[model samples]
Target: MLSLSFLCVIAFFAGLVDAAVGGGGLIQIPGLFSALPNVAPATVFGTNKLASAVGTLSAARSYLRRVRLPWRLVLPTTVAAFVFSFVGAQVVSLIPKGVIRPTVLVLLVIMAAYTLWKKDFGKLHKPVEIGRREMAIGLAIGCAIGFYDGLFGPGTGSFLMFLFIRFFAFDFLHASAAAKVVNLTTNVAALLSFAIGGHVLLAYALPMAAANMAGAMVGTRLAMKKGAGFVRVLFLLLTSVLICKLGWDLLQG
Candidate 1:
C-alpha cells in the first residue's frame, strides 16, 4: 500500500512533465521498477503505458480545443502509427535493442544540441512548407517512431515532437500538440497488446489515470497560454534529459 502510494505520487509528477513536454517515462518507468522490483519488466511497462495513455488522451483533447492541428497530416500519420505500432509490439522480442540504443542516443544529443544552438528555432509559427511532400514525411516519421515506441518504449514523444518541427515546419507549440495525437495512437496500440497479455496492474493504474488527467489539463492550459517559446524550452530540456538517461543506460550496459 505504501509503495502504491509512492507510485501514484510519481505518476502525478510524471504526468505533469509529460503533459508540459513529453518525457513522462523518465519519471514513471524508474519509479515502477524501484517500487515493484519483483514485477516483470513487461508488466511494469504495461502499467506505465496504461497510466500514460490516459494522460496523453487528456492532453490531446485539450490541445485540440485550443490548437489548430494539422489534421490532414496528423490523421494519416496517426493511422500509420497505430498499425505499425501493433506490428512492432508483436515483433519486440525478436529484435535486439542493443544496436538501437547508441543510434537513438546520438540522435537525441543532436536534437538537443541543435535546439539549444538555434535560439529562435521554435519561437514563432513559421510553417513555410506543407502538402503531399510534408505529409509523406510525416507518415514516414510516424511509422519509424511508432515502431520504436512499441519495440523499445522510451523517448517516443520527444522524437515525435522533433520530427513534427523538423519535417512539418511547425512551431514547438503546434508540434507538441500534434505529437500527443501520434503518441496516443502508439500508446493505445501498445496498451492493447499488454492488456491482452495480462501485464498491466489495474489497481494502481486507475488512480494514476485520474491524477494524470488532472495534470494533463493543467499542463495543456499552461502551454496554450505561454505559446511556442515555453514549449520550445521544455522540449529542449526534455531531449537533453533523454540523451543523458539513454547515455547512462548504454554506459551501464
Candidate 2:
C-alpha cells in the first residue's frame, strides 16, 4: 500500500494535470492500482472519479468566473451528457471496449498529428459560427463523448476539446473551459452509478478530493494566464501521452 502522504502527492499532481488539460486518470488510476492491487476494478474506477470530479468541479468554476462560456450550448450539452453518461455506465458491461481500442488508437494518432502540424490551430480565440446551430452541434458532441467516457473511460476531455475546436470553432482555452462542464456531468453520472453499486472508497476519496481541489485552483489560474497557445501545446502533449498509453495497453492485450 502506498503511504497516505504519497497518495496525497499523487492526487495533487493529478488534479494539476487534469485541471490543465483533463487527463488525470493517466496518473491517478495507475497509482491506485499499484497501491491496492487486490481491490476490485470498479472500486478503483469509482475512487478515481471521486477524486477527479472534485478537481474538475473546481476547474470549471474557475473557468466560469474568468471565461465567457456559451450558456445555451453548455446548458443543453450538460443535460444530455448527464443523462447519456448514466445510461452508458449501466450498459458498459454489455460492450467490450477491446473491439474499439484499435479505432481509438488510430483516431488519437491522427488528432495528435494534425495538432502538431497546425502550429496556430487553436491559439487565437475565434468563433466561426454560433447560436442555435452551434448549440446543436455541441449537444451532439457532448452525447457521443459523454457516452464514451462512461463506457471506455479514456481521453474524454481531449476528445471534447478537439471536437469543440473543430466543429464549433472554439479556441483551446474556451474548448477546455467548455470541456470541463461536460466532463463534470459525465463524471457525476459515472460516480453516482459506482456509488450505488458499492464501489467507492470514501476513506481515500476525501483527502484526494482536497488535494485535487487545491491543484485545480493552481492549474486553472495558470491556464487562464497563459492563454490559448499554452493550452494548445499542453493539449497536444497530453494527447500524445494518451495515445502511447492506449497503444501499449492494446499491444499488451
Candidate 3:
C-alpha cells in the first residue's frame, strides 16, 4: 500500500491540475486505485468525491472572486446538475460502462479535433444572449453531463468546458471557472450519496482535502495570471489525455 504522504502528494498535484483545467481525476483516481486495490469501489469513489469536492470548491471560490459569472445561466445549470447527478447515481448499475466508454471516446475525439481546427475557439469570452433558449441549453448540458458523471465517471470536466465554450460562448478561462462550479455540484451530490451509504473513508479524505485545497489556491492564481490562451492550451492537452485514456480502455475491453 502507498503511504498516506504519497497519496497526499498525489492529491496536491491533482488539485493543482484540476483547478486549472478540470482533469484532476486523471491523477487522483488512478492513484487511489493503485493505493487501495483491495478496497471496495464504492469507498474509493466516495473518498475521491470528498477530496475532489473540497478542492473544486476552493478553485470555484477563487474563480468567482476574479470572474464575473452570469448567474442567470449558471444558476439553472448548477441546479439541474445537482438534481440529475443524484438520479444518475441511482441508475448507475443499470447502464453498462462498456457502452458509455466508447461513446465518450468518440465525443472526445470530435471535441479535440474541432478545438484544434478552430484557431480562436475559446480565446474570447463572448457570451450568448441570456434568453430562455440559452437557459434551457444550459440546463440540458447540465442534465446530460451530470448524469454521465454519475453513471460513467470520466471526462465530466472536459465535457463541461467544451460545452460552455461551444454553446455559451465563454472563453477558456470563463468556461473553466464555470465548469468548476457545476463540477462541484455534481461531486457534492455523489459524495452525499456515498457518505450516507458509509462508503467514504474520512481518515484519508480529510488530509487529502486539505492538500487539494492548497493546490487549488495556487492553480487558480496561476490560471488567472496566465490568461485564457494558456488555459486553452492546457484544456487541449488534458482533452488529448482523456482521449488516449478512454481509447486505451476501449481497446483493452
Candidate 4:
C-alpha cells in the first residue's frame, strides 16, 4: 500500500483537478489502483467516491457562496442525476464498459475539437430563458449524463459543463458551478451504492477526504479569481486530456 502522505497528495491533486474542470477521478482513480492493486477494484472505486464526494461538497458550497447557481437546471438536473445515477450503478455490472468506452472516446474527441474551434464559446455569462421544453432538455441532460456517470464513470463533470454551454447557453463559470451540484449528486448516489455493497474503505477515505476538501477550496478560489475565460481554457485542456485518457483505455481494452 502507498503511504498515507502519498495517498493524501494524490487526493489533494485529484480534488484540485476535479474542482477546476470535473475530471478529478482521472487522477484519483488511477492513483488508488496503483496504491491498492491487491485490493478489490470495487473497494478502490468506493474509496475514491467517498473522498471525491467530500471535495465536491466543499467546492459546491464554496461556489454557492460566491456565485448564483442556476436553480432551473439544478432543480431538474440534480434530482434526475441522483435517481438515474443510482439506476446506472445498479446496471453497471451487466454492461460491458469496454464497448461503451470507444463511443465515449469519440464523443469526447468531437466535444474537444468543437470547443477548441469556438473561441467565444462559454465566454459570455447570461441566464437562459427557460420554458417547459428547456426544462425537459435540462432534465434529459442530467438524467442521461447521470446514467453515464454510473454506467461508464468518467468525464461526467466535463460532459455537464459542455452540455450546459452547448444546450443552455451558460458561460464556463456558471456551467462549472452547476456541474458541481450535479456531479456531487451523482457522486453521492454512486458512493451509497458502493457502500451498501460493502466496498468502501473508510480508513483511507477519511484521511484523503480532508486533503481533498482543502484542495477543492483552493481550486474553487483560483477558478473564481481567473473568471470564465480561464475556466474556458482549463475546460478545454482537461477535455483534451480526457480524450487521450479514454482513447488509451480503449486501446488497452
Candidate 5:
C-alpha cells in the first residue's frame, strides 16, 4: 500500500511537470525502479508508459481544446513519430545505452546553453507557412526523435518542445502544447507493445493513471494562465535536471 501510494504521488508530480515542460520520466522512472526493485525492468518500464500515456493524453487533450495548433504539421509529425518510434523499439538492442546516454547528455548541455544564450528564444510566436519545406522538416524531426525515444527514452518531450520552438517559431506555450500530442503518441505506441508483451501491471498503472490525469489538468490550467515565459523557464529547469541526471548515470556507469 505504501509503495503504491508513493508511486501515485510520483505520478502526480510527473504529470504536473510533464504537462508543463515535458520530462515526467525523470520523476516516474526512477521512482518505479526504487519502489519495485524486485520487479523485472521491462514491467517497470511498461507500467511507467501506461501511467505516462494517460497523463500525456490528458495534457494533449487539454492543449488541443485551448491552443490552436497547425494540424497540417501535427498530422504528419504524429504519424511519423508513431511509426519511427515503433521501428526504434524493434532495434533497441542493436544500440547500447552507454553510447546513447553520453550523446544525449552532450545534446542536452548544448540545447540548454543555446537556450540560455538566446534571451529571446521561444519568446515570440512566428509560425511558418505550411509548405513542402516545413512538412519535410517536420517529418525528419519526427523520425529522428521518435527513434531516439524508442531506443533510449529520455528527454523526448523536451527535445520535441525545443525543435518546435526552434524550427516552427512557436512560443514556449504552443511548443509545449504541441509536444504533448507527439509525446502522447509515442507513449501510446510504446504502451501497446508493453501490453502485448505482458509487461504492464494494470493494478499500479490504473491508479497512477488517475493521479496523473488529475495532475495534468492542474498543470495545463497553470500553463494556460501563466503563458509562454513561464513555460520557457520550466523548459530550461527541466532540461537542466535531465542533463544532470544523465550526467550522473553516465558517471556511475
Candidate 6:
C-alpha cells in the first residue's frame, strides 16, 4: 500500500528538483495521483500545493539570503502574480484543461528550442532601466505566468526564469531568485483557494511539507554555490524534461 511515508519521500525529491530548476510538479503531481489513487482530485491537488508551498518557500528564503535579488521588481511582480493566480484558479472550474495543455506543450517546445539554440542566453546579467515600461512589463509577465500557474502549473518557475532572462536581461541566478518570489505568491494564492474549497488534506500535506523543506535547503544552497552557468545548464535539462512530460500528457489526452 502507498503510505504517507512514500509520499513524503517523493516530496523531498520534488523539492530538490523544484528548487534547482522550477519543475518540481513534474515529479510531485504525478506522485500524488499515483500514490493516492482513490483520493478526490481536489484533495490531491490541494495537498500538493500545501506540501510544495513549504519547500518552495524554503528555497525562496535560501535564495534571498544569498542572492542579491531586486526587490523593486519582485515586490510588484509578486502582487501581480498573486492577483492573477487567484483569477486563474477561479477560471479553472469553468474550462476544460485539455485545450490549454497542448498549447502549453507547444510553447514549452519553442522555449526549449530557443534555449538550446542560444548558447549564451542567460549567462550575463544586464541591468535594465527601471521605469514605467519595465514595471508594466513586469506586471504583464507576472499576471500571464501567474494565471498559467493557477490554470496548468507545472513549470511556472521555469517560465518565470526564462522570461526574466529573455526580456529583462537578467542572469539565470537573479532570474531564478525572482522566479522563486513570484512562484511563492502564486502558490499562496492557489493554496488559499484550495483550502477555502475544503480540498486540502492536512494529514498528507504536513509530512510531505516537512520533507520538502529538507530537500529545498540542499538544492537552494547548491544553486547558490554553482552560479549562473550551472543554473543555465540545469534550466535546460529541466525544460527538456518538462517538454517530454507535457508532450506525453498531450498525447495521452
Off by over 4 Å in 1: none
Better of 4 and 6 by lDDT: 4
Cα lDDT of model 6 by residue, 81-181, tens digit? 99999899989988788888788888888898898899988899986867888888899999899898898798799889999998788989889888988
Candidate 3: which stretches are off by over 4 Å? none
User: What TM-score does prediction 4 earn?
Assistant: 0.97
Q: Give every collision pair in model 1.
A: none
Better of 1 and 2 by lDDT: 2
Residue 189 alpha-carbon offset, candidate 6, angstroms:
0.3
Error of model 5, residue 188, in angstroms: 0.7
**How many angstroms is residue 98 displaced in model 1 relative to the true structure, after the best TM-score fit?**
1.1
Over the full model, what C-alpha lDDT does candidate 4 score relative to the true structure?
0.90
Q: Which candidate number has the best lDDT?
A: 3
Per-residue CA lDDT of candidate 2, range 1-253, in tens?
Answer: 3555677789999888888788988998998887778989999999989999999999999999989977877788888888889888999989888887888889989888888888877776777657778878878877888788888878888988888788777899999999999999999999999999999999888888899889999999989999898888899899989999889998899
Q: Which of the two, 1 or 3, has more TM-score?
A: 3
lDDT of 4 by residue, 71-152 (tens): 8657898999999999999999998887888889898888988888898889997767888888999899889999999877
- Whole-model lDDT, candidate 6? 0.88
152-179: candidate 1 lDDT, tens digit per residue: 8778888888778776678888888998
Off by over 4 Å in 4: none
Q: Which of 5 and 6 is the better model by TM-score? A: 5
Tens-digit lDDT track of model 3 for 1-253: 3567878999999999999999898999888888888989999999999999999999999999999999999989999999889888888889888888888989999999999999999999999889999999999998998888887778899899999999989999999999999999999998888888999999899999999999999999999999999998999999999999988887897
